[model samples]
Target: MEDHQLSKSLQSIGKSCFVKNFELFSDAAISDLDAMQFLMDDQGYEQTGARTRVREGRRIIESGRAKDALKIIADARLEDSTLADKAYRLSL
Candidate 1:
């Protein structure tokens, strides 16, 4: 699905379902910044959603999901040039 359409569809169904479906359908991962945007903007999670993504991102990395975790960080930088430093720090 396209970004806007995905956002709209996520807004309609809610976060839990989105997360579940995301895990099931794709190996592609979500960046922390994108996660914040996805949760706060698309899922209506606000600031708490950003926090949730940070925690979840940390957990994913700590749990040895390194490949996926790195992809999350890399994606944020690759998708947005302005986020390079933040994404680098996030990966470290």
Candidate 2:
């Protein structure tokens, strides 16, 4: 991902935008999904899956971890055009 593009994307995700339309970076979401699945299948709490994921997402954004998450995604996507597409879709 180009630095300019990544910077623009991160700048766009302000507090109000993040709080109102909560979601995660694609990679973080996938990791959360894996943990959630484990909780539901092994720990016997189906409801914990969604609740835990949502709570975690909130914490990440509210605590400024979202910035870190987005940076990581951008770094991983660095030579891949899909970075722009992902940033656009996430409204980052």
Taking the tens digit of each residue's C-alpha lDDT, what string does model 1 give over 1-92?
34354344334433333233233223336655665666577556667655554455344434455343333444542444544444444446
Best by TM-score: 2
| Local accuracy by lDDT, each model | 0.44, 0.47
Which residue pairs show backbone clashes in model 2? 1-78
What would the per-residue lDDT of candidate 2 be over residues 1-92, giving only the tens digit for each residue? 34454344444443232332344323454565664565466546466544454445555555555665454554444445565345445545
71 in model 1: Cα distance from truth in Å? 24
